[model samples]
Each structure stands twice: as structure tokens, then as C-alpha cells.
Target: MISIGHSPDADDLFMYYAIVFGWVGDDLEEKFENQALDIETLNIATIQGIYDVSAISFGAYPFVRENFALLQTGVSFGDGYGPKLIRKKTTQLKKNFRVALSGVHTTNAIIFRLAYPEARIVYKNFLEIESAVISGEVDAGVLIHESILNFDTSLEVEREIWDIWCEKAQEELPLPLGGMALRRSIPLNKAINIESTLTKAVEVAVKNKKILSKMLIERGVIRVDEKELDIYLDLYANKDSISLNDLQKKGINKLFELGFKAGIYDVLLECEDYFIPTGYQALRNS
Candidate 1:
């Protein structure tokens, strides 16, 4: 059995249910067990080499590079929008403003740190961030996942993480948020088969989006209402998420570069160099 870890958000639910529903990879002999958790928990778990496959922040990849190979499919990117920094009142932030971030290792936290280096930081679950801000536990908070869409009226926009990412990037690229990673400890042939199965799962999910979304709603698996879930899937789990294209690859590399320059990671990583070597399977079959 292969264990998989993914977030409980709508986008992840949308991408992963194709596999859960047995819509893909029927020929594969491996059985998958899925675990739904918050992204921060999964990130920390990936660092420990806990799951055979997992969804992780792109920002967390460098730290887990030794044990995990980034998967080509099931990626989330922001074209011109992403995590939001919200405040209870519209006021100028002090140099040492207290901020609640989803996690220390999240992509939003990495970008937010670069943008506001002097801010005091605290870690909170994405679900608790809005309440943290409303209750004034922190002066501001960076909202990730679905929280980006449905914030309370009492809260106001402080900034967008995408704006910070754009400011720091060398060229315009989609903001890399999260993607799946496979444990490198798995045998190469099995890893290739698993990757192929997952790639097909993403494709099938996108093709059957409406049917799948209805099923998810009926099952009460998602947090948002049907309309909100539809919008969330369009933003994070569309066809572009099926695999890494050239542009998405560049975007991920740029994010790694940014992290390296900021001293968040010791070495710069080329996104493609770390992927599972599926071509070996082709060579073997040839």
C-alpha cells in the first residue's frame, strides 16, 4: 500500500478524488491510502519522510529535497493573485508589526518574510488566521487556501502575497504555491508507475470536474459552498495543474532562487533536475 498526504481544501479534494473514486490507474497493482491534513502539517511530515506521496508548499521543497522528488502534476499557482494579508483596521504598519502566517515553511510565509522583514511573525493554522486577526491577536495575517476568498467584513486587505512575489521575481511568472512530492526511497520503477498514475488522476479530475464536484458536495467533503468551491477549483486545480509546463517550471525555479538569495535555503535548486526520472522507464522498455 502507498500512503498519500494531501490538504483537505477544495482544490486538493478535486484533484485527489479521481484516484479515490478509482477513475484512473486501474492497471496499477498498488493500493493508495489517502490522508487529509492541513498543509503545514504535511510540510513538516514531508521533511520527516513520513508519507510515500504528499502535497507540499513549493517553498518547502528545498528542505525536503534529499528525500522527496517533486511530482510533475497537481500544482497550484497564482497568475496575478494569491494569499492575502489582512488587518482589522486600515492603518500603517509599524516596522515590527505582529503578523500571523499559516506556517513558518509555507510559500506565503517565505514571500511575506522577504517583503516585510521587520515584521514580528507568529504561526497559525490557515483556518485560525482570520479569527486571529479579528481578535487582534496579531496586527495582520497572511491568508492561504480558501481563506483568500471568504474573509470577514470586519477585516480589510493589507496586501497580497502575489504582489510581494511579483516585486521579488526577476521576470513575470505565476506564483508557485504548492505541488505534490514523492518520497525518493520508493523503488524507481514503482515511482515511475505511481507518477504516471497520479498524472492521469489529475487529467481525469479536470475532465470530470463537474461530476466530481457534485459528488464532493453531496458527500460533504469540502468546506465551501458549491459556488465557492467551483471558483476555488478554477483558481488552483484547473488544466494547468495537470502537469508542469515550461512556464510553471520557470516559476518554481525562480521561487527557489528567491529563497536561496534570502538565505532561507543554502543551495539553489533547479526544479526539473529533482523530478523522478520517468525517462528511465522509457529507456528500459525500449
Candidate 2:
């Protein structure tokens, strides 16, 4: 009886769960019977113990640390989905500049600081940031989530913060887009099994080509272009990259470096047995 929570951007993986977890036909009603609300709402509701597993943004790390006991691991959309430093198509950042973000404590804010340490960062909602950038409220804005896909290219991409991280780290670092995490109350063995199951499901979905295409079409999150969907899935559904060990050590280290450089966090919070040893080895071998 796992109560899973995620954002709308994760609908494709949710649909895969609907198929693999026997929730698609008459079982759909039973599977999500206890779902409190949408992913964002449910994550907020985590303070009330409404869910055991959650998919949360990296920007929510500070909140999660203060509010919950959980382990962060699993599949993510990768670094490409990180915040983009954008300016007007004609504008450029010569020296220091003012940057608008979705929120002060949001993930984009953290990424913006890491990428442009010299810039002045301001907070704004997603819609407001778009308007602000266009209206010249700020010199540039950091965009995230669906905004990356839906953004009007009239705004030029100054730099992708994740791309910068990749260049600096010299590895294809997972940008903690979001992934499944379990509360401390859940048994450790059960959490391991669930993680293994999800890893396998993603692999199967990736291989099945047809299922991946159908999922994108059914969700309407993206247009009905197989090539586009393929690219998205390939970027997000990285089978070998989803493991507790990599996320805890490699992934967390990279994020910590970014956070420290950006001044969003002081240091990475340590966790015990954060990675499953066998799973880590398998990912390495693959």
C-alpha cells in the first residue's frame, strides 16, 4: 500500500505505473484510492503524513530536511531540465545582472545562483517571471520544469545551468529533477523492493518503444511527435542512473557543490546507508 506523489511533469511515469501496477482497468479505482491530491499538493500534505513516498523538486530540499525523514533516489529528467538563464533574444549579460526566479527557495533560484554567482537574484512566479523577462523587470530569468518545454524561444537561452554543471563536474550529473522518496516509517526492505520494481519498469518501458509513444500521446503533455518523445524519454528515463548509491554519493555531492557555490545550502546533509550496495554496483557495471 504505497502512497506515491509526483508532479504533473511526471505523468508519463505515472502512466507506466498504471500499466505495470495493474491499475489500468477496473483496478485503477483501488490503486489511487488514497491519493490525497495532485503531486505538489500531496508533497505539502507530507507534513500531515498523507503519503509515504514522494517525488519532490531539489529546490524543496531545505523544506524536506526540516519537515520530513526520507531518502532521495530514483529516475529523473536529468540536467537538461535544470533552470535556464535566459535573456531577451537581443540582450546579453555583460557584467552583473538582475535575475528573476519562480521563488526564492525554489530549485531554479538555487541553479541560477550556481550558474551566475555575480547576478542579483529576485523571486517571481513562473508566469510573472515570463512577463518580467519580456517587460524588462529583470535582465534575465531562470526557468524550470514544464517551462523548459513550453518556453517561448522569443527569450534567448543565455546559458543552461545544468550544462555548466556538467562541464564543471566533467560527468553527466543527474540534476535531481525529482524522484521517488520514502518516509522513515516505511520498512527498509520494502523500500528496496519498490525501488527495484520501479527501476525494472522504466527499463521495460524504454525497450517497448510502442508503450513509450502511446504514453506521450495519451498524456498530451507533449505533442504527438515520436522523435520528440523519444528524445524526452531518453533524457529522463535513464535506467542505469536510478540508484540509491549514485544519488546519495555522486548525485548529492554534485548538488552540494552547486549549493555551496550558489550559497543556497551550507553543506550536504549526511544520511546512513543512503545507497543500496548491490544496486550501486549494478548501475556501475551497466
lDDT by residue (126-240, candidate 2, tens digit) is 5567778888889888765445655666798888877876775677766655545556565545555555554555555555656656765676645325565565555665553
lDDT of all predictions: 0.92, 0.57
The window of 10 residues in a row where model 2 has the poorest summed lDDT is: 27-36
lDDT (tens digit, per residue) of candidate 1 on 79-139: 8888999998755689899999989889999999998999999998899989988887899
All candidates: TM-score:
0.98, 0.70
Candidate No. with top TM-score: 1
Q: Which stretches of candidate 1 lie over 4 Å from their true place?
A: none
Off by over 4 Å in 2: 10-50, 62-73, 77-82, 92-96, 103-107, 117-132, 135-137, 166-174, 219-226, 241-249, 258-263, 270-272, 275-286
